[model samples]
Each structure stands twice: as C-alpha cells, then as structure tokens.
Target chain A: MSTPRPLTLIVNGEPRALQVEPRTTLLDALRERLDLTGTKKGCDHGQCGACTLHVDGERVLACLTLAQQAEGRRITTIEGLAGPDGTLHAVQKAFLAEDAFQCGYCTPGQIMSAVACIREGHAGSAAEIREFMAGNLCRCGAYPHIVAAVQRAARALEQETLA
Target chain B: MMDFSYARPADLAAAGAALAAGGMALGGGTGLLDLAKLGVARPVAVVDLTRLPGLDAIQVSETEARIGALVKMSRLAAHPAMRAALPAVGQALLASASPQIRNMATIGGNLLQRTRCAYFRDAAVGSCNRRNPGSGCAAVGGVTRGHALLGVSPHCIATHPGDLAVALVAFDAVVETWSPNGQRLLSVHDFFLLPGATPGQEFALAPGEIVTGLRIPLAPVARQARYVKLRDRASYEFAAASLAAGMSLGVDGRIADLRLALGGVATIPWRARSVEAALIGEHPTPAAIAAAAALAMREAEPQPDNRHKLALVPALIERTLTDMVGEPA
Candidate 1:
C-alpha cells in the first residue's frame, strides 16, 4: 500500500491533521475522517449544493475542494454556526419558523448559503435571493419557503442591529 | 476513483515545473475532479494551484483588465471592477451554473471544462471520440439536438460549453499562459480550436503550460455588449444556443463597429467575423442586423436534430443586438 498523504485542515474552528488519500475531497474529509457529517454528500459532484461551506468567509462547494488545499484556511461548516451555548443561528431560527424544508437533506447547505447571502447583502429582492441561492438544489421543491426564510432572517438581523 | 500524489505549488514557475515533472495541474478542479470521480481522468499525480500566490487577482485599468486564471467566477462576477469594466462578462458569469458552482469554478477551469455530451460522460458508451480517439462518435446519428451546427467535423460534433469565454472572445481577450519554457499569450479566439479531424486534442495549451491570466482589451463597444444564452432551463442547463455581441453605433444610428461571437452551436466559440464585417458602417435597423445574422448562419451545417438552431441563431442575434441598442432615438 502507498503512504497516505498528510493534510492539515481548519474545520469548524478546529485544526486537524490527518493522513488521507489524495482523492479525499474536503467534503469527504469533513464527513469521513473528521466525523463532521453535517455537510451532506448529495450528488458528490459540484452540481448539488449539499456540500456547500464557507472557506475564508466565501461560499464554496466543499465537494470539489481537495482536503490538502484547505491548509490554514478558516472553514465554517454548519456545525460552526451555533453559539457557544448551542443557541441556533439567526438563519437557522428563521428557517425553522418559515418551515423551509421537508426532507431536510439540503437544509444545512441552504441555511449556510442563506446566511452568506444576507451577510453579502444579496437579500434585497426575492428574485435576487432565488437567483443567488440557485446553486443549492432542494429537490423537495421548497424554494418559496426557503426564500421566505432568507428574507425573514435578513429582516430579523437588520432589526436586531437597529435595536 | 483512483488515488494519486498531490502537490501544492507556490507560484506559476513552481506550478509549471511541477507540471513538467509529470503532475497534472489542477485549477478549481470542478471539471477534473468530477471526471476523476467518474473514472475518466486518472492522472498519476496532481499539482494543486489553490495556494499559488498572485494568481487570483482581477486587475482592471483604463485599457484592460487582467483576470487571473484562478479567479473564481462568482468573485469575478461580483467584483465591482468587472461590473464597471465589462458588464457582459459579469452577465455571462451570472448566467452560468448556480452561485455555488460559480464560487468553486475558475475562469481557466471554465475554459477547459469538458463537454456535457451524455455519451462522453458515460465511459461504458465506448464510442465517444473525445474520450477514446478513433472510437466512432455516437453523437452523429444519435440524439444530436445538442450537437454542433458550426465547426462540426467527421470526428466530433461536441459544442464548446462556456458562456463567459464566448463573451471574452467577442471582447478580444488575450490568454496568458506559463510553461517550463517561458510565458506566452494567445488571443481567446485562437485558444479554442475546432476539432477538425482530431477531436482528442481540445485546447491549444502545451502539456506543461498553465493559463495564468486573461487580458481583456477595454473597448467602448463593450459598454453596449450583451451575452444572451437560450436553454431548456433557466439555470444549471447548458446553452441550447447563445450569442455574445458587442457593438458601437455611430451618431446616425448606424453600426460603427461590431464583434459577434456564438456558443452552444459549434465545436469552438464561433466568432462571426463575416456578420461583424457586414454590420460595420451599416444602419442598426432590424433588417440590417437580420441580413448580417443570415450571413452568419449561411455556412451552418446542422445535424438533423439541431436544424432548429439555424432559425434560432438568427432570431437570438437580432433580439440580443436590439436589446443592446435599446429603443431607437
């Protein structure tokens, strides 16, 4: 057997060094080796947003990113968005209130990308938010609800700041 | 998917050396990794360019904007400089795959992404000329609605699948590449080639060369440019037919200059020089644009399933150009 490759990744605010195959994607590394299975593997290809995560504060498809290329970068998975005392993030709360998911397979990616969308100021219009979030495929056809959730989250966050 | 050795190079020189040392250069990996997972591309070693410094900047100036090959399409589309310098490029990027894929896909990778031909995707087909050279092209008599109407050869009829590259070609973009020998630049029009008789060799890059940046010359015409992609679906689907047109009209409402390039209908991004030549110095009326578009589609030899493109091409061009010109004064 060949020697495994050494990879150091900062996942969910923690640094981890592991020996993995060169074919290990960041999604696989998070799910298989590090046991952070919150990031789903919907298509395993880049087509689906089930593997979306924030790398260096920008949304990226973890399914296409190599584990070895993530060195020294801040990776924010779904698990990282919660408070220290385990309170839900604003986006997650809005999603729950909006009933944004049915099967919930794509909820994590949707919520993650929704938070980024609001933070990036792309939540101005429903159409714009829909266009921005088109990458994360929710096969359950929960698009209307998802968009409503993102809008609600943006409004709630704005009100909190104003208060 | 077979495992391989991976290396992260620090700079273009190091990446070129790594490529010369028999490692496949990986950029974005949206295409390469997908092919690898499908068991199509199994390189012995991979050279990752994610950490390579100075290759991700989108620099804009009065004359031009040099887009680093590693610049993600999402960032490129969202960049204020790109929005101001060339809105057509940003429009094309926005029309591409969802925001998630754009975030991970790079400009260079977009240029080099493989075709969406089903036969080519299925390794078991065993007759895709692109996958296995000299294997008969199954697309010829098969479901050829997505096949090329221009630049179709006996060997292959796969259409080039990039929207932004088509617009870049119309903008007269230059591709800068780095190799072990040295650096070289190629016009975007020449970077992608028609398959002709040999469909295996798709791009013009040398074995060890890596695309460093794309230089898009700033032209006043770009301000009035448009990239219109018509497809079965609004998102995630490849173009059924598309047009990238940039034009400048004279004071008399006539075409002073024009650059028209097409995608989803050719083996390469089809630059309609004939149409552009005819449109220049002509009135920007629907009749004139239609006549030029007719000239553009004169040599199109469409497959049985794609003959609809012959009609769609002209209409798309007219609508796209008209939209760019806005209502007549």
Candidate 2:
C-alpha cells in the first residue's frame, strides 16, 4: 500500500486539490477523482491518445503521467475547451461542422488533440494534420473528417488572430 | 500495478542519493510507467528528474552539438537549428513516437527505453531472459518477426527499439553520464551492450549513474545525413527496418566518407562498419553499391519469421546509398 499525498493541480485555470496515491495516473485522477470524465481512457499505456490533454499548453497523454507530477502546471481537458458561457471552441465547432466523429467516444480527445495540433503549428496541410493527429486513434475511421475539422479550425483560428 | 513512493529531488546529488537507495530515476515516465503497469519493472520508489536545472539546454558550437538529456523530444525535433544542422537526428526524433508521447518523453529516456519484445513485456509469460534471468527466450521459436538478426544469442533476440540512438551511433556521438563516483563519457556505440548469456543487463551504465547528455561531432557526414524509417505505418509507428545513412563526396566525386547504422533490425544500434568500409574510396556505381550494401547482412542469422528482414536490410541499404548519391536505382 502507498500513502495518499496532497496534490494541487491547476486544471483549466483553477486549482483543484485532491489526495492521490503515488501510482494514480493523471487519467484516473481526472476521471475518477476530479469528476472530469470528459478525458476518456482508451489504452492506458500511452499507445492510444484518447486521454490526451494539455499540460502547460503542450499536449501529453494522461494515462502514462502520474497525477503527482502535474503539480503547478496549467492542465486543460476536453471539458474546459469551450467558453465559460458554453460556447464551443473553434475546434469543437469545426468538429461538429465537419462531423469528425461517428461513435463520438473519441470526440473529446480528438478535439483536444486537434486544438493542440493547430496551436503547435502542425495543421498547415492535410498530410501534416494526419501525421500530427495520428496519436489519437478512432476505431470508427473518422480520420478524413478529423483532418477536415482540423483544417477548418486552423483557418478559423488564423482569421481570428488576423481580426 | 505495484505501489511505490514518488519523490521530487532538488538536484542531481539528491536524485543520486534516492537512486542509490533503491529508487528509479523517472525521466518523462513514459517508458518506466508503462513497463510498471505491465509489472515488467517493479521499483520501490521513483525520483522525478524534471525539476533539476541545467540539464535541458541545447548547446551548439562550431565543432559539436551538445543535447541535454532532459530535453523533450518534441522541442528538440522542432528546434530550428537542430533541424537545419542535424536533420537525421531531428527526423529520427520526429519519426519515433506520437506527438503526445514526444511532448512528454525526454531524449535521455528515449535512448534508455526498453525493447518492445512481446514476451519481455508480459510478465505473465515465463520464458523471457531479459525480463527474468535464468529463463529462456520464448521469442525465438514463438514469434520471430520482430526479433533481432545481428546481435543475438541463444538467450535473447530482442530488438533495441529506438530511432535517435541509431542516427547518433552512425555519427560517432559520445554519451555523457554522471554518477556519485564521477562524471564520465563513452562512445554511444559502446554504451549499448550486446545481449549474451546475461541478457538482462542492457546498457553500460554504472550503478546509480544517469545519462546527462550527448555530444555529436559536426562533421561533413553529420551535416548531410538522413534517417529512412520503414515502418508498418506512416506516423506514430516503430521502424520495421530503418537506416540512418550519411555520405560525403570528394572533389573527384568518389565516396570520401560514409557512415551507416541500422535500427529495429538488431539487438543494439548496429553500426554497419563493413558497409561503410567497402563504400569508401569507390566511385558511386550501381554494381559497387549493391555489393557493398549486401555486406551489411554478412553475419545476420535470421529466424523463420524474420527472414524477410534478411532481404529488407540490403535493399534498404542500397536505396539509402542511391539516395545519398542523388540518383534513381
């Protein structure tokens, strides 16, 4: 048995405190402890990126990351992607506009990864988006839609910046 | 999963102390945590190496490029100077893992990552020499498709699954390490050990020693290198049979210098010295390149399932050689 340590994680611009064991992964902490179930756990060994989230503005897999290691970092998940008033983020809106999901189980992770992919400046073309977003696997074969959604979101974000 | 304690050490001394006390040093935790989940590694405690300073700098001089161990793979691959100067190293990093994993994984951790043998990963499997000493290798007759061809013993035939190390080995990079005893440097080629009777012992690191960085010489070959990864997929996949090759031509257009190393097809990052020797001092020709490239597999002992790699290695080497010569073969 391991002792539970106090961990204060900065999630979506807010500090959420919890007591977690040393072996508790960030995926489990977000879903089971913090009630942030939007970040789904697909393969908990970092092979699948269904639990993709942002730590300090960079995307990383939550399943392989220990919750204790996320201290003092700005963590963002799928639930926090939209505006506080419930307006969907540009990526989220583009995902809907492109129908980038079939079963919808992988939507949140796809959206989260797509957001980071564009921000990382890897969404310049369809091939680049496909290669960068290859981490997030979707069993429903939504890659074409996902690429379109990323392209749409990239254009939207670029226009917003220009505006 | 086993229960273990985690510690955030302030400096290298504290981190070494914890490691000396039967704790594993966690860098990115990408490899260690995954193996721990499978019960492959059972550490009693882990000390995080992220908070330590000065180990994350990328220093480039006129003579060499020094990459700190704690630098993330994504940051290094995306670095402008590294891509411009060491494109093979950058391509290797970009081709190794997914974006999310590259974002979290460190360069040191990437070099020290374990082999992706199925028998070794599953602790439930009994016959794995790398995982359990005195146990036999189940991968030899079980599933030999991904098994190594070059550095194989009766005990183990696991492939060293790393991309960056292969390119570094081709470029004569030096691995720098620190220990409670002292600081030391070793050739990256010698850092990886051949799996013999004791297949469990992997690297040449001393007890409680940690890799600090790697220093790569800025040679003509290093400047004009490329990493060709033949994998099952285009992205987020390990190499099936990859080649890291570099060549420099003389004023007469002959091969002045050449270096070759293989990944995903050998037990260690294999430097194709025989191939390099045969190609040097010869004019780039179809027949000459073919004969030299075939020497890469002179000593390969392939099994039933992996005999395809026997055909793949020489062809990949020839293709890379042709690419270096700026011709179609």
Candidate 3:
C-alpha cells in the first residue's frame, strides 16, 4: 500500500492539515475526517447538489472535488455562513421565514448555495434565481418557497446595506 | 474503491507529462472521480489538473474568444463576453447539469465527460460498447429511448450527452490541443468523431494530449444563434432533443448562411451540413426553414424507442430558427 498524502485545507476560515487517501473527496474529508457534517451527500455523482459548499467564495460540489485540490483554498460551509455573533445570514433568515424546506435534508446545501447565489449577483430576478439554483434538487418539491426565500434574501441584504 | 496514486501538477505541461506517464488526467473530478469511486475507471495513477495555471481564463478578443479548459461552465455562461458573442453557447452551458455541477464542472471536462448510458454506468450490465469495445452494444436491442439516431455504428449507439459541445459544433469552433509533439488545432466537428466501427474511441485526442483551450471564430451569424433543448424535465436532465441553429439573413430576408447542429439524437454533435447546403441563398421563409429542417433529419435512423426523436428534431430546428429570426435587431 502507498503512503497517504498530506494536504492542508482551509475549512470555514480555519486551517486544517490531514493525511488522506488520494481518492478521498472533499465531501468525505469534510464529513468523515474533519467532522463538518453540515455538507450533506445526496448523489455522490454531480447530479445532486447536496454537497454544495463555497471554495474561494464560489459554490462548488464538494462531493466532486478532491480534498487535495482544495489545499490552501478558503472553503465556507453552511455552519460558517453566520456572522461573528452567530447572526443568521440574510438568506438563512429568509429561508426560515419562507419555510423553504420540508424534511430539511437538502436545506444546508440549499442555504449555502442561496447565499452564494446572492453574493454572486444571481438573485436579480426569480427566473434567474431559479435557473442558478437548478442544481440543488429539493426532493420535497419546495421550489416555489426556495425561490421566494432567495428573492426575500436579496431584498433584505439590499436594505441592510442601505441602513 | 481501487487504489490509485495521485499527483497535482502546477501547470498544463506538467499535467500533460503526468498524464503521459500512464495516468488518467483529472479535471473538476465530477465524472472521473465518481467513476473511480464506483471502480469504473481504475487507472494506476491520477493526474490532478485543478491547480494547473493559465487554464482558467475566459479571454474575449474583438475577432474571437478563447476559453481555457479549466473555465467552469457557470462562469463561462455568466461571462459578459460569452453572453454577447455566443449567446447560444452560453444558453447551452446554462441548460446543462445544474448550477452546482456547472460551478464545479470545467469546459474541458464537459467535453470529455463520458456518456450517461445506464449500461455504461453499471459495469455488470449487458456489455456496453463504449466501456469495452466489441463487447456488443446493449442499447442496440435493449432500452434505447435515449440512443443515437445518427452517426452510429453496430458497435455503439450512445448519444453524446453534452449540450454545450453540440452548440460549439454549430458555431464552427476550433479545439486547441497541446501534446509533447506540439500544439494542434482541430475543428470541433472533427474533434468529436462519429461512433463508426470504433465505438471505444470517443474524442480525437491522441495519447498524452491535453485540450488547452477552445478558439471560437468571429462570426456575425452568432448574434442570431440559438440553442433549444427539450428534456424529460425543465432542468437538470439530459436533453431529449436539442437544436443549435446559427443563421445569417440578408437585408431582404434571404438566408445568406445557415448552420444547424442536432444533439441528443446522434453519436456525435450532428452538424446539419445537409440543411446548411440547402438553405444558403434561399429565402428565409418558414417553408424554406422547414424544408431544410426536414433535410437535416432525412438520414436519421432511429432505434425502436428513439423514433420519437426523429419527429422532435424538425420542430426543434424550426422553433430555434424562428426564435433567432425574431430576436431584437
């Protein structure tokens, strides 16, 4: 057997070094190794976005990314999206207000993606948000509420900036 | 999962060199990693290209656009230049996979991604020609609702699963590849070959070759281009049938030039040269477009479950052309 490779990843703004197999996905490293269970794994394949997270401020499928590839990159999970005082991100608040989930298995990934969607300027219109969020499948069929949450979050973020 | 050694190269040349050392190249790891986890692509080594530099830019010039291999599909679609120069390509990218997959999936990976054939995905299923050549295509007589209707061979009938590649073929884009020998450029049409006889060989990339960038030529016709995809669902599903149509009309509503390519109906991106040849210098009327659309699908030989695709092709082409013609001046 070959020796395990050492990789250093910045998860949730914290630097973590670990020895991992070459085949370990970022999702596996996060959930199994680092104990960040917020990023859920639905389809290990790219078809589902339950393992969504932010790699350097952009939403990426953690399940498809190799842990070694994320070395030195800033990774933001759902647990890290809150402020220093643990105040909810505007998107998180909107999701709660709109009840954008049912079983909530996909909510973490959805919320992570929703925050990124707004930050990336994809919350312009409901259609745009729907298009951008198409990757995160809600098996519970909560699409309308999810879209509404994104729209509300966009408005809230805009108002906060004005205030 | 099978054990494999992995190496992350700092640049394209190093990545190519690692690939030359008898390892499979990894990009985005969406497709390849999944296959590896399922013990499908059991290579001895893996060359990681995620950290490779200079392969992540979307450069737009006045006359052309160069998209790096590592450029993510979401970024490519959202890029202002791509939206302006080749809206059809952007639309196709936007229509592919989902936003999360799009963000992680690179343009090169999207082109090189394997088919979504159920038999191919499940190695224990009836032998798949694409996974193992000459093993016989289960799709030929098996469930083939999604099989190819054109440019297929007895060996394989797997339809290419890329929407963006189909549109690229319609735009006559060139694929720029780098190898140990030197750099070579190939038209997208030639880059992806028909599954004739050799179904195992998909892309035309040689051993140790890396697709560095895609060079899209400057064409005014692109302004009037459209990519229309019909799928089982409105989003996040493979194309049931798709049309990428590029047309340039003269001032008097006559067709100066026309380029049409079909997806989800062929082993490769089916460039409708037959349709283009018939429509040039002809009047840009619905009747002429219909005639050309019919000509485009004339040679379509659909299998038992895929015959509906033949009917869907004409309507998709007509609608795509109509939309392109109706866009704002």
Candidate 4:
C-alpha cells in the first residue's frame, strides 16, 4: 500500500483537508472520514445509486470516484441539501409531502437524485422523471410516490424561478 | 480492492511515460473502480489522464466532429451540436447505463469497457476464457442468455457491453490514440477484437497507448439515424438485442446511403455491411427491410440459450429501418 496522501476537498461548502490512503473512495471519505453517513453504501459498486452525490454539480456515483480524483472539486452530499438557515430544500419538502419513502433506506439517494433530475430538466413529465431517476433504486417499492414528489418539486422550482 | 498509487499527469507526454512504466491510464474511473472492487482489475498504479490538456474537447463542424476521448458520456449525449448533427450518437449514449453512470464514464473508457458476461465478472467461476485465457468457458453450456451470437468461438463468447461503440462503428468513426510512437488513427471496426483463441486480447490499443480523441465523418445518413434497444427493463439495463440504423433517402424515397450495426449480440460492435448493401438504392418496404435484416445475421452462430437473439436482431433492424423511413417524431 502507498503512504497516505494529503488531500483537500470542498465538501458541503467547506474546505476539508485530510490524509487518506490511495484506495479510499470518495464515498468512504464522506461516510467514514467526515462522518457524513447520509450517503448509504448499497452495492459498493457502480450499479447501485445509493451513494449518489454532486461533484461539481454533476450527479455521479461516489463509490466509483476515488478520493484523489475529487481533489479541488465541490462535493455536495444529502446533508448539504438544506438551506443554511435550517429550511429544507424544495425537493426534500416535496418528498416529505408526498410520503415518497418506505423503510427509508434509499431516501437520501432518491432525494439527491430527484433534486438533480429537476435541475437537469428531466422532470418535464412523470415518465421522463422516472426515466431520469432510474439510477436510484428503492427495494421498498416507493417509485410511484417518488415520481410524484419529483414532479411536484419540478413545478415548485419553476414557480420559484418565475417569482 | 487493491491499494495502488495514483498519478495525475499534467500532459500527454507525461501520461505516456507513466503508462509506459506499467501503469493503467485512468479516465473517469467509473469502469476501473468497479472492476477493482470486483477483484477483476488490480493495477500497480493508476495514471490519471483527465489533467492532460487537449483530450477533453468536443468539436463539431458541418462535415465532421472530433470528440476527445476524455469527454464524459453525459456531455456527449447532451451536446446540442452533436445531437443536431449525429442524433444516433446521442441516442446510443442515452440508451447506455444510467444517468449517474453516464455522468461519470468517459467515451474512451466506455469503448474499452469489459464485457458484462456473468462468467467473466465472477472470478470464482474459474471457466471464463476472457478472464483467464484457455481456462475454458462456462457460459457455453451454463447461463448464456446474455452471451454473444454474431461472433463466437469455442474459447470465448463474451459480448461487448458498450452502446456508443455500436453507433460509432456504423458511421466509420476513427479512434485517435497517442503513444511513444506519436499519434495513430484506427477505424472503429478494426479497433475492437473478436474473442477468438485470445479472448484476453480485447482491443487493439497497446499497453502504453492512450486514446486521445475520436473523429466521425458526417454524412446525410447520420442525421436520419435511430437507436432501438430491447432489454429486460426499460431503463438502466444492458440490451438484450439493440440495433442502430441510419440512412438518407433520395427525393424519390429510395435509400441513397445506409449504415447499420448491432449491439448486445456480438463479441464486438457488429457492422452489417451486407445489410447496408442490400438496402442502398432500394425502396425500403417492409418485405425488403426484413429480407435485408435476415442477410445481416446470416453468419451468426448462437449458443443454445441465446438462439433467440438470432430472431430478435433481425426484427429490431426491420423495425428501426422502417421507423427511419417515416417522418421524424
């Protein structure tokens, strides 16, 4: 194994400097090092989207990203989705309003991806939302409600933009 | 996963040097990292190529387009110029993987992606010739529902698992690479190798060579292309049988030019040159398209469990070609 390297990541709007082994993934860094445990590890492979997050505003699988590869990039986890003043993000509110989760294992990843789906303009229709958010899988079978939440959030965001 | 050092080279020359020293070049790390976790790939060091300049540009012109190898799959799928010029490229990219993966995977890595054969992925299978040449093939008699049909041998039958390469091959795209010997261009058809006696030798890329870019010529057929993918699920799954068909019709409604390729059914992206010849200058009727589609898979050799692909491939081609002749939706 190689020696631990010093790396800095701008995680959740904060610059965090840490020493990590070369094999450590960005998912592991967020969960173990920074204690941001909201990012779940479903498969630890790229197939599952339980570790979805935004790296430079692009929704990517964190487990497939090496910690070293994320140096000097903006990282946003599920915990960082809320406003600094303690208000929930519009997408999060829609998820709660629609009761879009069961067993809640895939909630964080679902909400994160839903937020990105709307921002990426894939929320034009319910079918389109489902197609775009196909990466995040919920074993508990809350897909219908999740799609509704995404649609609702998309409308809310558009209204906010118009205002 | 193995713990290996990572180096981010500042330039292509340094990247070539790093790769020459027995290191694997890392693109988006979507494929490499997944293989590492599965214990399939364990390199000594990973030379990061994203920092290198001139390998991430996507240039589009009226006649052609040059897409850098490091360009992400998501960007390529959503580029306005690329979507307008070569719609099949976007269609193929969108049909592949999922949104999150497309955001992370690069074009170079996608072309070089390993097969998703169940036997090859499971190292414990101990019979995958692609993973261990001459070890024998378990999929030949085992679970072959997802194996190859167009190109197969006794040694290996793993299907190539990329969608973009399928579309690129139909257009005669050229892959540009850099090495100590300078730069070289390889046609997409000759770039991927059949899993013959040497299933381990998957690509023509040398150990120290790095894919720099891809050049695709724009033809009238390119604008009228469509990709049809049939899979177990509607989204986020590998194709059971996919077809990419493109052609331009003359004012009289006859085929002026055509290109066709198949995915999820071959050891490499299978270009149907025979089918192209059958369609050119002919009016595309249902019967005519069906006859041509049958000729495309005349040489297909399928395993017991995957013989259905022989039927599925032609049906998909006929449908895609028929749709291509109709009004654009």
Better of 2 and 3 by TM-score: 2
lDDT of 1 by residue, B236-260 (tens): 7789998888888888878888989
Residue pairs with clashing backbones, model 3: none
Candidate 4, CAPRI quality class derived from DockQ: high
Q: What tens-digit string does per-residue lDDT give for candidate 4 at A1-108?
A: 799999999999999999999889999998999999999999998887999999999899999999999999999999899999989999999999999999988899
Score candidate 3 by lDDT. Answer: 0.86
The DockQ leader among the candidates is: 2
lDDT string, candidate 3, A1-163, tens digits = 5578888999888899989988788999999999999999998876678999999898899988888888889999998999889999899999999999999999999999898889888899998998889889899999999999999999999998899
Clashes of 4: 0
lDDT (tens digit, per residue) of candidate 3 on B11-82: 667877888879898888888988877666787888987667788899988789999999998889989988
Error of 2 at B134 (Å): 0.8
> Which portions of model 1 miss their true places by more than 4 Å?
B327-329
Question: What ranking emerges by DockQ with the best candidate at the front?
Answer: 2, 4, 3, 1
Candidate that beats the other on DockQ, 1 or 3, i.e. the better one: 3
Q: What stretches of model 3 exceed 4 Å from their correct place?
A: none
Residue B160 in model 3: shift from native, Å? 0.3
Superposed Cα deviation of residue B327, candidate 4 (Å):
2.3
Task: Report the poorest 10 consecutive residues by lDDT, candidate 4 chain A.
Answer: A40-49
What is the DockQ score of candidate 1, to 2 decimals? 0.71
